[model samples]
Target: MTYTALNKQVQSPLTEQDKRIIATIIQRHADEIKTLWIDCGITVWVQLQDGGRLAFDRNWFAQRVAEEKTSLEAQENLHRQNQRLEAELKQACTEYGLQHGEIDYLMFSTKVYRGRDLVGFVGFHRFSQMWTYSRRATEPDRYARSASDALAKLGVRQLTMV
Candidate 1:
């Protein structure tokens, strides 16, 4: 039967035989059935010829839509946060007279200095997701404040000085 005829029949009150015929046709053209239920003011359930049933609740549909919207919003928020972090990093690099490439290349061997005195070695630690500093060959507590200040100026929040 043509889709127009099937649509007209579905719009009208259906008898048991009519329902069976519609179910059979739907099973044969499952991909073409974009909308399963019409405005009959009643929940509709149809068993296909293969014994699989097509059914859904309006409440379930609404819940799924809400979930998708929440997921999209969370993704957008994460993207914005990443962008803000990147901008902050760029600004910090410029203010500290440091280049991202230099930091990356000399992360492990580079020494951070305050004026003419060497405070510590600056490097990025992958496991801790932080920039770390190892104090020079001296007391562990020495240059702690200077190391903290230097890392802060570079926008490195996750910093550890030892």
Candidate 2:
């Protein structure tokens, strides 16, 4: 089956406090790689309606640094490997494999709430790498079979796919 993302259950621009919190979250994530995927550079925390902004600050213009500095040949090889893996996935699940126009940025959507009211939105984050693959989300559905019961303990209703 295909995935459909959720629109906001509430509407309004983020309050100053919300902005500050988001900023702090970004600053905190930069140095301390918490959760690897959820709070890292690749994990973009975009709001739902009309699209949104990053929860973390991405250095819009940063020269290649230490670990990230790679030669062109290595980059090309990685690109080819990713392409091969993507083709394999498409062949495995043809129906959901083709994303017409969507960027299909790897992500997961979680309800945002403040004082029991839905407010902050959870966004799609990377599982690993900065890969821009869509079908990757199917992995979460597989996890849901076990995660749902545990999430229910945290008061979550269900694990929705995107």
Candidate 3:
């Protein structure tokens, strides 16, 4: 709706594309988006074509991010557990010589969401490398050689998620 003053100062002028994205975010996530933006200390504000200004807080955005991180961890844990159980079941089927169906390796996309709104998604394959590099960066001793080797082999592509 209506905002009198931007909670934080925005240096860049909002573009039409930004407006569209914000409108989509607001429409899709509603209160969660507002809360997350406010929590994260990020600004989403625009001077409209009609000359009215809209503003939102960054801290609110962070809340959504935090929630999403929690959700992702939970989902990943559940998925790993399910995979383990499936493997056990498959082993049993093999022992009995039963016709076991194909075991599909479920690859999920790591979605970047602002609350319920999906801003982007990184596929499982992409995320795996991301995890590897990030792990190497943080824990240098464990992956130093492998990380450097990967970087040598893949160059910048090793760091890119897209």
Candidate 4:
């Protein structure tokens, strides 16, 4: 595997110490995390002003669907369905990647301001099974509260309405 892009714009600047701080702060709110994110299938992906982005882990997702699907399929059709599901997952991830940073495609897009400066953006979307992709740009604020709370934890102090 190639290990290029050290200090390049494409490189992730997160350090081991930074990761530990984030992990520790998050563990303190396990219940809220479960309710706001895990139980609801919510995602609050961030893209920084410097062009760095943190997106959903597609490889992990594909592996997760593979494990969950075996239990949902009959013995004879399991392999076939698994193959189809894997392909569908890949396609779905590709489409999400394409639309992720675009404001027009977002159900809710918020500017993350740390103090007075524009530091990054937190884009929220409801993810689901392979077939159910986002269609409505104007989804209800039923999810916005949870997204806002999550962004607050990420150090976003304010949001400029779009």
Per-model TM against the reference: 0.36, 0.21, 0.32, 0.20
lDDT of 1 by residue, 41-91 (tens): 444444444555565465554455466557667767756654553454455
What's the number of clashes in each of the models? 0, 2, 20, 0
What would the per-residue lDDT of candidate 2 be over residues 1-162, giving only the tens digit for each residue?
A: 222222232233554444433434444322222221123455345342333334533443123222233454466675675455445333322322222222222333333332354322222223543222222334332122122222332243442347
Per-residue lDDT tens digits for candidate 4, residues 1-162, read 342332243334554443333334333321222111111244323334444434345444445445544544554364564455444433432432221233322333443343354434444443522122222334332232343343344443443334
Judge candidate 2 against the unseen true structure and give its global Cα lDDT, from 0 to 1. Answer: 0.34
Error of 4 at 74 (Å): 32
Compute the lDDT of residue 1 as modeled in candidate 1: 100
Please identify model 3 stretches exceeding 4 Å from their true place. 1-55, 99-162
Rank by lDDT (best first): 1, 3, 4, 2
What candidate 2 gets wrong by more than 4 Å, as runs, is 1-70, 95-162
Higher-lDDT candidate among 2 and 3?
A: 3
lDDT of 3 by residue, 1-162 (tens): 224344334244444444334545445422122211232346744344344545666556446546655766777886885465445434433332222233334642222222344322222232333212121213332121322232232222223323
Q: Ten consecutive residues with minimal summed lDDT in candidate 2? A: 141-150
On a 0 to 100 scale, what is the lDDT of residue 66 in model 4? 59
Best by TM-score: 1
Give model 3's clash tally.
Answer: 20
Reference-based lDDT, each prediction: 0.46, 0.34, 0.38, 0.36
Which candidate do you rate higher for lDDT, 1 or 2? 1
The local lDDT score (0 to 100) that residue 125 gets in candidate 3 is 31
